[model samples]
Target: MAINPDAVGTTGTPVESSWTSKDSLLYAVGIGAGTTDLAFTTENSMNIAQRAYPTQAVVLGDASGAFANIGTFNPAMLVHGEQAITLHRELPVQGSVVTTGEVTAVWDKGKGAVVEVTSRSVAPDGEPMFDKVMSVFIRGEGGFGGERGPSGSRSMPHEGSTPDLEVTLTTREDQALTYRLSGDRNPLHSDPSFAALAGFDRPILHGLCTYGFTGRALLQGLCEGDPARFRSMEGRFSSPVFPGESLTVRMWRDGAGAARFSTHGGDGRVVLDAGRVTFDPA
Candidate 1:
């Protein structure tokens, strides 16, 4: 099905999901967490300890079979295009949460529509903890009469310029499989036939799963495994990366401890761009 131009930008079919603690920890493990280096960290350990520690938390929960929901867009024609996240209360350190997801923006991108879905995770005490923005690209599903006025994009902080620091993360061939153990059962990353139907040579990993891995790397490289010091992170998905690919993140540090980050494939094809990460006072 194709997107209704008249339906773009207007909110429809909002989905609200309430989840338990086990589901929350499952997403953490889904991103490759049980090892000492990764699990020992505060967030990972906290997710693991939740069975023991038990607090309040929330994670990515979609309101619709989002990709399949677009009227004129086929699931095979969709791709992860971008991600933006903001944390309000350090992610609950551990339990149960009610998540509300909604379509916030629909941008016309020639033959595609950039659908931005925003999910808000609220704790049981009525406190909002984290917010996530996921952008999915629907190829050949644009031009729905939406205004395509003058618009551009953000430049990478370390692009064509010197970077303050650089970090490389190597993904294992079984990475996606391991990450899936967390909670995501999307066959796009599991079944070969499903992946082929989606036009991929093999199933590709979830972009948010990658985001979680990047979060682990960034926390280790910059935050020193301190979740308390993490403020926010934003990045654009430049391309899809296969499992077992080595990812190198380039960061640009600015005055007063601000920084920007981007990652590329081994061949140096940019897979993520226009990324920025901020931290709390040290």
Candidate 2:
């Protein structure tokens, strides 16, 4: 399936959705937040304040339907390559939101097409809450002879002395099942048979789930467990993580209130790379 270059700039129908406190708590649990922090996973705790994980923006917008406009591409051959998210305001535990998105660019990569998508969500009051730019690679969907597209800025490796902090999260065996409740019902993360056909021993965890865990680590390690301070996060998916694996995220302070970090799976493979997180000092 060759990608249609014309699909670029195509906008999708806007979606209106709402979520509650329970929804936020469940998303926190799905990413293993409850293991070490009560603030994110538990509904109520004596010492910790309940809050929504920042990475939940990926679900709050839910722009998967918009991608269908880009022409036919094998679902099994698609993979998330990169993701960048910016938070304009702290996410509420319960609120109605309006999300709209558009295809930004499509580049031919010989064996595939790299599609870039940009989506934004606004609160019921029409104030921007968060925005995300995602890169998805569609395998065997290239060769239509299109432009190579824009190049991402180079991410600098971690510098300075030892890591300022580290956090480890252990995923549950059914982590993906719980994560799916957040709205992404991709078979690759749930259906064992579908996963097997996709060349996995069993269903794999959602890359975004790991992304959420990394975000949680950033919040805990540097942001004082405050969601309001989380400003932006960007990272590349380097490898897949199983549901039951433990991931360790090591962070190095990059600037005033920013850090460069990476998450390593239980097998010692870097699951996330070229990661950067920024937070408001105030």
Candidate 3:
């Protein structure tokens, strides 16, 4: 009930964030990358140059600071609703950035409220590096009679057509533990007792971890394994995925430089939907 609709347009002070080669390597392995993906998983693999994943931009900066202006709400009742990232250029193995975050929108959905936050990051030289948009749904924070907002259309694969690319990856049982080291350390992804208190039977995987995995598929499948060619990706979190689940990302080419995708968990349920990715086509 403390949700501040007026929080929209409020910006936070710029914060400097930095990361190292080891951080990038850890992120690659956290997202299920392995020896085969040497360029990302190793910094000194005999002639293999280290490169940060395009999606790693999401972790290089912290944007949650702007949430303070959004007013108080039960943290346990909040869940990631949607995520998006745009990379102006490929990330370096070690780099620093200054990020400024803002509250872009707040929508009332009757049963809950959805808040959209955006962060813009710039390299030390003042060059734009990446931008991130994150949406979170807070249960019981709605019904204030505010605007309902636009209900966007879903981006699904062409009817009855097979996916142009399908990459299935299995997450480790300790995936959340590794991903947590990057920045986010939410208890819902690690503490079973806390998860149960949040109505989950057990700990669940971080939505961003799933997003990182899906981004990997898009990079290899559409960008020819080149991070520089990967442009932007956006998707909604439709369901919860437990650790150790197999994720199958099915991508369908939409046009010359665009693709639509959905990720299904091992149970065949769509864990990520309305996915849209754009890259420099090979």
Candidate 4:
């Protein structure tokens, strides 16, 4: 069986997610925004900055309601593989914005299935603010009679159990509120009733926010805080992380360059698994 790209693109229902300024700044901090002693001070945070020229934003907007086969495929088997964000303009400190998301494409690589989504963030003024594409790969979800296609695959780390480096950080009770100021406000992370309706006990942290924090920690430990030496970072969100808790991140460096990462909760429960990141010599 072969997979239909057209069918894949149109299979899922469409969705609209909103955001705000606090969302972007919070996201910046989650990705290590503060610089030096200035990082935490009020004066430093008020300034909108980026590690580099490309300051893009990514969001974790789930479309569970529009899922094709909610039960058949294991969501656990899903792993975020690729992400790209484009900034249209500087995000305001606070306001409401909507992000419309749709299934962009899907590719089959014999070993797994890759699903891609394209999102458009628009301001209330109807001006397009940015465009983003997020992707996920489901391992062992292939050969379900779907046709294989061109795709990029991650090379697994060398065989063997290696001792990993772990770092844990505790988030403030209102961490989500702070993180959201960075530029995301999907309501699911801020509104309890909305979250409960979405199937979450309470508001949850953004997946990309966690990803950015993972990158920040990696850059600190592996790259010595040099952004240019960093090549790429990717991961999957196995579970939702609540605010006001300790997040423990474990790192497995394959060599002096590439590394694999994951994070667990203070309770030692895995929050993010199957995380892979890469870096280069400065």
**Candidate achieving the largest lDDT:** 3
Which pairs in model 3 have colliding backbones?
Answer: none
Model 2 regions lying over 4 Å from their true place: 46-49, 150-156, 159-162
| Candidate 4: C-alpha lDDT | 0.60
Worst 10 residues of 4 by lDDT: 48-57
lDDT of each: 0.65, 0.86, 0.91, 0.60
lDDT of 2: 0.86
lDDT, candidate 2, 1-282, per-residue tens: 657789888888888889999999888887777546777777678876777888888878766667878988777788899999999989887787888888999998888899999988888789999999999988898888998776645454754356778898788899999999988899999999999988999999999999998998888888888899999999999899999999999998887978899889998788998899999875
Question: For candidate 3, what's the RMSD?
Answer: 1.3
After superposition of all CA atoms, the RMSD between model 1 and the true structure is 4.2
lDDT of 4 by residue, 6-119 (tens): 545443443455544445445556544554523321233557333331232454333443235222456646666655555555434344456556666666667877777666
Candidate 2: clashing residue pairs, number: 0
Residue 275 accuracy (lDDT) in model 2: 90
Kindly indicate the candidate among 1 and 2 with the higher TM-score.
2
TM-score-based ranking: 3, 2, 1, 4
RMSD of each: 4.2, 2.2, 1.3, 7.9
Structural similarity to truth (TM-score) of each candidate: 0.80, 0.92, 0.96, 0.58
Per-residue alpha-carbon lDDT of candidate 1 for residues 1-282, written as tens digits (9 for 90 to 100): 557544434433434455555555555555555555543323435444442111112134444543333456676677777777777756543444556666666778787787777776667676876777777778887877676533547776457987667777777787788767655678999899998987899988777666766666666667766666776788877777788888888877765545788887778888777887777756
